[model samples]
Target chain A: MTEGSSVPQRCWQIDSSRKGAEIIRITDADGKSLIRVKPGVSAVIISSASFLEVILEEGARLELLRPFLLDQTLEREVSLSVHQAKDSSLTAFMVTKGSISFKDNVSVVLAGEGAEVSLNGLHDLSNACEAHSLTLIDHVAPSTKSDQLYKSVVRDRGHSFFHGKIMVRREAQLTNAYQLNKNLILSPEGRVDTKPQLEIFADDVKCSHGAAIGQLDDDQLFYFQTRGIGREEAARMLVKGFVKDVLLKINDPLLRAEAGGML
Target chain B: MLNIKDLYASVEGNQILKGLNLSVKAGQVHAIMGPNGSGKSTLSKVITGHPQYVADSGLVDFEINGQMVNILGMEPDQRAREGIFLAFQYPVELPGVPTSEFLRASYNSVCRHHGLEQMDPIDFDGFIREKMKVLEMDDKYIDRAVNVDFSGGEKKRNEILQMAVLNPRLAVLDETDSGLDVDSMKIVAHGVNLLRSKRNAMIVITHYQRLLNYIKPDIVHVLYQGRIIKTGGPELALKVEDQGYDWLIKS
Candidate 1:
């Protein structure tokens, strides 16, 4: 059995601590890979049950499968700032389905000529649970870009917010960026707010943003019903389709299947 | 076989179909002709289970496979599964859902209700290709969104294409030829004529006799004041075209 297939348990747990915690660097030395989340590294963090600061160098990749659950009072911080030298790529997936408090944040800074980064995450809040995720991507070089697509489904007074800012410096010309945030209010009183900002000081760039909030399609419901799909099954299919679009993009098939089972 | 008895329906608190009655049998075509505000379109809507129209009191029964079935209590989707298809006057433009996907979903839905295995993509492609060839429609319309960005003639042809694909037991077309040119009108009628069979019935609703000139309905009913005021054979449509509804209104 692999680490992903170990448990179906739930609890409130914390990560371990680190020594000399000023700025720790995990590098993919000559022909090696960066962005390490192996058992050795994660065990150190999970065992410590505390906060730490980490920095990532160029050509590094990481995969976050389980929740980075931090206790509510600790207010832990994890910052990842990457610089792609030339023709490098970075991808990450954050999957959280439970109530996790403690002010978790991800601060990303990109600096390279032809670097691309895709940050995608999905949080499912149901049965009076609360989860918050804050993501920031900064562009510090020209001809570099980033894309963000995030979705949330909240039920029974659950809350979700995604505030993303794409900062194109005055000298960062010929940059391309896009951000999309969509939410489905499963209950009448549940709420969600999405804000996408483009602060550009350069004129030779293309940027776009959008936000949509609505209920399910009534005609689609009737269409399914006429075909003998029960109301609850139809609703489940729509909701699952909405989230599967993001989770299934992960390159690791094991992680993708795990997410599928969760749904 | 289908029957409508003393149907009354309204929309937004205004009555549209008042005490309408009609009956259609297998291996037959009935053409419904009327001027504007004569409740011709409303009759079709109420029969097809459109939610906008509220049925005050009416009964629509269909004898499917020699069994009488009441469709008044069924939803539109249920009505569709039970083999009642409405070729809309205005086909909806579904933006993201591809035509092939929509067709397969609709086809499989009805198939599943009848206890049949769903057709895979490979089989469906061949099936739709043959049907499209019969209609002389471009192959591109098969993969594109349903009626999205289609020309007026193209939309009407698409309605006929769906009729051929679903092959419903009964088809009711509402003003399908209002916007077509002469060539498109012929193509539309040809497509409909090809699909007419003894096991399936049809009701062609239009204001002019031009479409009837192509498909040739077996009977024509003149609708005025939300009711069928007159019924005649195929010659009646030609008479209405020669002497418009103005004379019929006076009589």
Candidate 2:
């Protein structure tokens, strides 16, 4: 556990060498935290449980980056919960690669007025791996906003499932929410299931959700071939282009490049 | 130099070009005027080996460095590498691929086909900037995605810019001047005129004589129902502009 009045400039990195479950808490006012979990961190999780809980004080901010690398024989499960106070903000980026089976559940609560949240994620799965990601965002106060975008690319026999739920209580008036999920299937056996749900009880709220599943555009591929580009190279370029929008959300250039290469 | 003899083509079980024959010599510009659905665009697609257009029967040959090769069996990319270029009437937009990177990839592919050395990034940037000047294009377009969110005139200009960089032996312009203002038309024609040389041939397809007024054509052919019905000097374009395709169709 780490408690402090202020946050350091650098992100708090989890020890990849450690094993078993761990928990961290932050409750100080104006406290900030940046959590980064690099690839292969699941190898140290010998136990079946691993969880992270973050509590943000008023006007505080939290940023999280979880880039997962595939481990063939490992199955990992992780749960994350975030509670935002008045005028606080939370931004998160989650990217995952291969795993035999991986499950992640994320919950966010905008408990105070003027709270905002933005969440973006990408999953690149290949082989016989599977990934399930579930997100729940709750608006309990007035004048709250939330935006979410998630994309997945499945290849070979890989499968991915994404379920996002946004709920606005009766007292949460003047709420604004948007959610979008997109998937690209590369092979015939690749599969993706996405569901975006929004339940708003406030009369003055605005909410929209969208989901799309598709393959590479054949016409665009042929257009590239006309310019003397080989089919394989053209396909690679198109895949990168499809995910470029989500990757752009990452502010770090080096990390963005690494994410681009994974595709 | 290119030659097509008794070409027949179809798309999705519907015949478009039936026994079409035409010839274009080096150092000459040929204008093909026709009404809508006269198979003017089909000719260009057949020549470039578009996947959708199937050439049922034809002899399409091109002279490349003194070697006459039959291009009917080659792929679109192969024909492109062999010095055949087509400026599409509607250029496709690639949302996330930068124009500079796309152009570099294309240029290097052609270079590799010809056993030429590839240009480095800095050298390629300088080279593309020089070519962009010919089309009067702004410097910002190179950094943006290929044709993404480009205006009509800008898309046409970008097509010409690509032609200037590729420098193909046989160039086909399929309604390149369909939608353009006076200024943009002049810029596009100027770019085309600058690239014309004695070693290259051009086949310009259009429905109106507006583009011909800028880039003068040596020979004018009236195409109707997939065949060249009439061939004459540049004066023929004036006749079609004065009258309409109704007279030619009736004749």
Q: Considering only N, C-alpha and C atoms within 3 Å, which residue pairs clash in candidate 1?
A: A15-A46, A15-A48, A15-A49, A16-A45, A16-A46, A16-A47, A16-A48, A16-A49, A17-A48
Clash counts per candidate, in order, are: 9, 1
Q: Local distance difference test, per candidate?
A: 0.69, 0.82
Candidate 2: stretches off by over 4 Å:
A1-50
Candidate 1: residue A256 Cα off by (Å): 8.5
In lDDT terms, how accurate is model 1? 0.69
What's the TM-score of every candidate structure? 0.74, 0.88
Could you tell me which residue pairs clash in candidate 2?
A70-A98
Model 2 C-alpha lDDT per residue in residues B107-138, reported as the tens digit of each score: 99999999999999899999999999889999
lDDT of 1 by residue, B1-251 (tens): 89988988887788877788899988999999999989988888787776777888888888866887878787777787777778878776654456786677778878888888899999999999898887678999987766777888898887787778778888899999989999889888888998899988999999899889998999999999888988999999999999888888887
DockQ of each: 0.22, 0.68
| Residue A165 in candidate 2, Cα distance off native in Å | 1.0
